[model samples]
Target chain A: MSPRQFDQRHPHPRPDDDSAPPPAGSGAQARDTEVDSLLEEIDDVLETNAESFVRGFVQKGGQ
Target chain B: MGVVTVRRVMGIETEYGLLGVGNPAANPMVMSAQLITAYANEGMPGSARARWDYQDEDPLRDARGFRLDRAEADPSLLTDDPQRPAPEGDLHRVTLRRRPGPQPEPATVANVILPNGARYYVDHAHPEYSSPEVTTPRDAVLWDRAGEQVLLRSSRLLAQIAGMPEIALYKNNTDGKGASYGTHENYLVERAVPFEDIVAALTPFLVTRPVICGAGRVGRGQRSEAGGYQLSQRADFIEAEVGLETTLRRPIINTRDEPHAESSRYRRLHVIVGDANQLEVSTYLKVGTTALLLWLLERRGLPMELAALRLADPVRAAQEVSHDLTLTRRLDLEDGRRMTALEIQRTYCEVLTEAVQHAAGGEAAAPDPAAEQTADVLARWADVLTRLGDDPASCAREVEWVAKLRVLEAMRRRDGLGWDAPRLAALDLQWSDLRPERSIYSRLVAADAVERLVSEDEVAAAVLHPPQDTRAYFRGEAVRRYPGAVAAASWDAIIFDIDGAPALQRVPMTDPLRGTRAHVGELLDAHPDPGTLLATLTARPPGPQT
Candidate 1:
């Protein structure tokens, strides 16, 4: 199935610029932009002390 | 034609992973209780006092037609009794004693039956949300998402309390340490279908189900000591093919026989092998396909191919399937044949597809919602298995493991880091964080990187109202309308202590299909007071009361 048909069946989040579809063959570039922005966002809010944070996350066993 | 569909009584229970922002040493028991209390007391008023009625719960009774002796049972198996944190100076003493003054009263609200027909309570050290029963998988995903909103609200309210440490909840199964909690799914099955039949027919399906719905893990072993990723978070933790114990020797098919319904007719299949999924599509298919499989077993006896497709060692195969990211590892069968996990899943899917068509008798019936949904699940199941076989990356929109792997791979490629990087492990944990600002999955949802099966409004509405098709409607409505008189409630009964009644009024809802909105909505609306409602219900004719 085409991406549009799949999106129609299972709804995807509408992009910010929904007024017009991107020009041909821009799908790869659009995905790269999305990944880059996500990484940039993660860099700001990710926990600073990664090693200690990972080590200290101890949980009691549960069912 | 016999009804062959995914419509069955199914529900999900999630045990959230909680962490104190700065106080890593805080007692999880106390913190979990505080989270429940915060939600009940401040988030939803008048729900704080409705205690859970555990009279019908018999956790030791096994579906294998026997009961383990209480002396031999694990302490975690004794779940009927009210669980209180150990008292002061005990072995498990409360560690939230940082203040110089006298110790404050422990958070007393351990359990509350919500207006949404859910049980928000503390199960051991983690806050558990047991959703109300829903008959369809789409509703299953909606209500499960509602449970997440419950946790998010509880966290926000608890953080506002004076001197209360900020708590973050994760919709995940493991802590990347050895300790693993559960995100269990329950399906109502006919008791006439012997337990052994279920065990035999369901083992291979459960062993290979992770290819579609696994919430990816960053490390190999349960302790995260190994330096690799896997498809499932709970695969390494599974040690048994079938057993009664859940905390130790975790089983693929848990034999807990607590139906919480008419014991003679229904047996609630307690499934503990699944990960707590975040994507809506993952949760939808996880429940939908399983329900369809159970329908197939109940209607038509196990297909010949399914009967012959038993794994040689299901426990080992479960882990092998998870670890094989290439999606091409062959698993050995008991019949001396080998097949990849994808092939096994495809066999089940194809069997059900043919069964559904045969049941229809090549005649087009009028459009039925249940049959349509079953067809939808079958189509999606086939689509997912086919896509996974082609390229696992193509399934990022609908598969939880694939979606998570994409984000992790993106980060690794950008930073030139290996699987052992602490940043990647931390990112894995934060992906499940409840806070939208901190969760990478939430960021993906916002970026339209994921697909959604339901809308935000549907989830929000489910948070306030229970599904109108099950006995949960009566339970949720009674709690919502007459909060002052609902003394306690369980799966099959509700106890009301009206002011002038000689004794407590007990109403037994033995049938899960009855007591729905169609049965008692008007009765509930007619009587604003619990006393009159009880009187009217008792005064009705004694023949087949709705």
Candidate 2:
């Protein structure tokens, strides 16, 4: 299948800037930033070492 | 007439479809990942208020049970959405990072809950929520039902894409015989207690859950030491050895001992023996009944009666339970109360009836009432057992066979194995240890891949649209693998087939044992089609081998 077709099926494309409004409160905003950072790190880790990360996770009972 | 103290304790986790392997076919994992991404993008909206039964702790509570709203509101981990969509309802967007290669259409859909205070993602593959703990069982039901609806809604987009296989969540541990599976559950224990008492009190109940929840399996003809035969809770023993050690090796009760709390006393009993029950009644009973049992064991301090009442040989008892279902074993308790299995069922009902009554009332009482269906199902299951308990010759093979088929199909259609790659990987996982000819199975997979590549054909298309009479083609191929399997010289005894190739010969199925290497070669020689072999061997759908 073409890349675009696969994307159409799963649709995890990067978030466009105007897609969602900011967090409700400043506290919520800060927490979202933290989550965003962690998500970024997770993406990096998954992209860099997909197989080993999965293997390690499984070995650790998928915790 | 008195102060009704309602304890608020509840938690929930929903394991979603995860797709690490990439396939275009609507694999649950692929579709789930995609949905999650979409939900995330849409800004997970927090429901206005928690469900009445969702027993989330007041974010205001402090160490001394005082309000903490002044100092700091406990930062919300999840966006609380009371009106989440049904499993078949609306869609949500989740975001996934772009990969380096030509990115396949966002291969994952996640419902984005960007810093929402209500519902949020728990893990990459699983979604979880800790409802405000509730005092009444009635309330817990709402949270459970709500969670189910949310999962169903979140899963709709993916399910539709993947041919909408009816999906279910298990609330028990393993398929009785040998396999270990998930039994998702939640509980509200005291926030101040020792882990020792927790393990001591819960271990026995956790270990023996299979007794009530185990779907019965046929006993392989080999007699046990107590002269009782055993079969796996799973239907086919062709790919798995049905035996006592097998059950013991992969235990139903797992204790990683990781308490998901800051303090030791607060531990949610995480159970995993659940089968994916199809019937709504079975699922309701699966969770509601087991939760009641745990509630009783934890609060009432019921000692492990089944273990003590256990037959001289467990394998025998297991076999008897599997075979006749009604043969009652007597369990003698510490209080000099000697009860047969039937009596225990009666007493269990009385206790649960009273317990629920007391909980319904504000009075402290001895024993707990049987949850709604536990008593009736136990009695009926026992009756079925008793009716057939005396007969050794009369076979209700058809009923048992149907039950086995139901279990088999339910297992095969789980959300996790929705994709071709993982489904195939799962078969490989199941057969890793039991392959008759390890090298030969591996070689066939390798050959299939090469053949497909050489033909420039896609395996998915191959499965959805086959080249010929699938069953006969597979059968012929399988027969070819066992050229010398059955020797004409030994018409009665099995002859060893060494070279794995097709042989047109019939072998008696009654042989007690056959040489392993030779059998493997012979079986492979039969040249059975991969599809048929997978279906018969794994009780699963055949998928692409990559």
Candidate 3:
């Protein structure tokens, strides 16, 4: 996923661009934007350190 | 009541394996009875014999068009008993104080809805722990872990009771005797979205998911060829793309069209394809990614490309993904394209990213909480896929199958045995055993070899408290405050005999987001008793039903 516009806390933050949308509620906007940056770090490690996701495991019978 | 909450009320029901008992001749039925009795006998504060209402259940009503046979519709028949009461009283306290005698066998399925808005019950001869409704994947992990804690504590307590050998629980699907239980997931989807659309979209995604989140298996073929290790334990068991029966003719997309939310507004997607993951990371990713895909399908109609993503034969693809650990197995897609499981999974991830970006790019896109969750899912999904694409062993910490494979591979090399060795199969069973000391997964978690998503503190907190954002808040509070008054409780409504009223009052929680902390906290506080609370709640206008 491409890095998007976010404040210091939220990395892939919600779209804060809409000042006041008629249909959407403001309850969701209140949460802290702290989950994305950590995901970015995990993203980096998984990209490099964590290797293949489906290797080393095989069926019990000869395939 | 937000823009995307119809997709947020999610929960998981896991049937745990009972081991460590039946030494000389430990009957599972007898052992299950003991474990169920242990919890019921040692009743917690919110414990009562609150009846489980089965009025809304209609499993036979397929998401497609026709109603299945009555036998197929009644999923609760597996655990239903009208006389069974909720676990109440201070049995745990009494058991601790006195010399525990032979525990009485429970007459019916011991269904105890915990204070944390989750249900702990014995179903189909297994102690099943169902997590409370949660808004996101992260909460799903925390609450799911809380269910594990429930199993662990109950198992430990059973060990203490005399005449009862220690009980062991495993968060796995299969019992290795060809009989498989389920790790069923329920997700709220817009009822407006066609059920056929859901099956078409989810079939391929569910089939390929084992490549990333599968709990590795040691043996092959549930009732067929049994020599090779498969990627997932549940794969060989799923025989069709869509079906109403979970026990017989288990399908990839379960048609248990029992929408726990309001029928007109929301439909519950009963996902049966997933494996019960031991790794917290795998659990998080499994739930998070699936929720995102569902949201994408619900908000925007199922894309044509997604339909094109379907496998030529879904059952074959599901099994192939498990058997082919090299990530090189190619599935014939609906578009006549043969794609590897890794490729198909990555494509889903890529589409998820594109969809999120597309939504964000919209002009009046509000600051949605789902955006934050979607971000979490996207990053984790990408990370796991990258690791899986690289050298599957590297993901040993986060991916459950990899971690178990590493343990088994090391043992096999040390013993100089083949994968088909019976000892290796035993080791595989030992890996999932929930006994803290004996469980290899527990050992891995202790040694910091497995990646954990939620903290133990979060799990503990969830065990005692319901989430503040869903109808679970009200269900939990009602049970907590009026254990004696609660006549029955179901997903969408609660039947309570408030103030000893002759007739039971039905409190309908049609909107999953309405009876939340923000919506009903003050109301709950104002009316300290069940009688007053029901009167006040009913008097209030039907506002914000969304």
Candidate 4:
């Protein structure tokens, strides 16, 4: 086994690409919006019937 | 349209420690059960009061669209309440009555619920999360996140719960001395993949898993010299064995042995890696990157060229991986190629990123734009780790956590303690003789034997004895003390608490007869009393064997 190294430290540089796709700003932002919209709809349902949702969802996989 | 690749939901379960303040006689398990029931009855959406009292909550829903409860009481950990009103002045306080409330029906309490609607609970003393069988790759990732949310929520809730000691949920295997505890992760693989093939491909990366996924650290050197740094992220504690035989001794990556009804079929890979990372980033990368590697294997992108990548001492390897960055040492691959820990990790991430991109696009397909970006982030993370090897002064939270761990480990060593040291087997040996039916003498002899052995090992290890050898010696001592537990060999653990005592510590095997009797009763009630547990402790019995 390699011995452990504990003292080495370096400052991390910022990413060079501002236009990086998917996981970066634009793609993640778009995904976040979609998730928010979906969550809102679910929340609306929850406001009226939290118990039914819990029962139905919890029953998906047997306890 | 071309066949769309999908991800499935997966999750993890965490158990909490329970306490009863002021009352020294409080039973931790009963308290945990009560706390769990209380949380469960608070309903899927906790009332404002419930949320204030309990700290954990998750917005994600499980497959049934039910919110899962990520973290709950282990129903095993025992502790005394420090603040219990003592009519008489003594350390052990009186037992308290169960609080009045609507208890969760037996069925609901049997398994805990996560905000995601997933259920998790304790099987034996350990908290277990059996991931919901996933249907798509994306869901698998989401499930892991959901599971983590539960853990985070549970951690907070446990902190808020009254009369409980601070609970630490280790995500790694035991040091093999007392109880080889650890965290486990599962992934569904194509059934056609043989276990041997999976092991062959996975071992190399597993050796280097710490690089991209290792939470950064700063700590004293593993070598006993006055002052050197330890670089590997995984080498903070002493633990051996990459895998443990489950309670059933089933292969770590168990074979379902059943054919799937659907045209698309796969087997689940259950991996037990002793990694308990404090950082969410570390947890995310640990699960995410490993899953990607599994995907890489499924796509035939893994290279088995490094067949000789065996570690002479995996226990050492496990410890070396957890050290903070001041230590520098080279590991020799099977081919005798010496590589720095960082170099190995960088190469692994680079290889995996390329493989993921290729597989995502299909045969010679254009790289998915999303994968390309993720690959870059992973590469940078690895690079940062490599450059920052073991610098204690470094300020990254991940690095500091490791540093603090190293400090704790140092304290253990100075105080003659071994994490996951070999005394565990001896402890099991004594506990083995402690069936509810066994004579108190047998139980006392077993528990005392373990406590004595662990104490000796701790002393020896404090004098700079090697951890692996020390643990091995403890295992040998356990066999000598209680030959029956070893022969019958039930690795299951029974947890109980004395009526009084605030330390929240596991009972020493060397305890007096009365404590051992209580422990035995607790064991019998919680789990089936093992018939062979008594004789299992002796190393070599001279008399007639059971």
Best DockQ goes to which candidate?
Answer: 1
> Which portions of model 2 show Cα errors greater than 4 Å?
A1-63, B1-8, B16-30, B42-141, B155-181, B191-251, B256-264, B276-280, B287-546
| Two-chain DockQ for model 4 | 0.02
* B276-364: candidate 1 lDDT, tens digit per residue: 99988899899999998898888876778998889999999999999999989999999999999999999999998998888878566
User: How would you encode candidate 3's per-residue C-alpha lDDT over B1-546 as one tens digit per residue?
Assistant: 234322377999888776544352355666666676676566354455565666554545567767665443455433333343222222111011121243463464467677777877766667777888988887888889888887777777777878668766777877555778889999988888887788888888999998778998877888425776777979988888787777777889887776766666777888988899888778878888888888888788888777789788999889888999789988998778999988888888897788877766744545665556667678778877875776566566678888777666655655577876655565566577676665667666654556666667777888778888898888887777777777677776677775545466666676787779888888778877878766665566452222
Candidate 3 chain A: 10-residue stretch with minimal lDDT: A54-63
lDDT of 1 by residue, A12-53 (tens): 333433344444325435555667778888877689999998
Report the lDDT tens digits of candidate 2 across residue range B217-290.
32233211122212223222112111111122222332322222322354454443333322222233345545
Flag the better candidate by DockQ, 1 or 3.
1
Shift in Å, residue A45, candidate 4: 41
**Who is ahead in DockQ, 2 or 3?**
3
Query: How much lDDT does candidate 2 score?
Result: 0.30
Local accuracy by lDDT, each model:
0.84, 0.30, 0.69, 0.34
TM-score of every model?
A: 0.91, 0.37, 0.82, 0.46
lDDT: worst 10-residue window of model 3 chain B: B90-99
Q: Tell me how far the alpha carbon of residue B181 in candidate 4 is from the true structure, in angstroms, after superposition.
A: 3.5
Please list all clashing residue pairs in model 1, or write none if there are none.
none
Q: What TM-score does candidate 4 get on C-alpha atoms?
A: 0.46
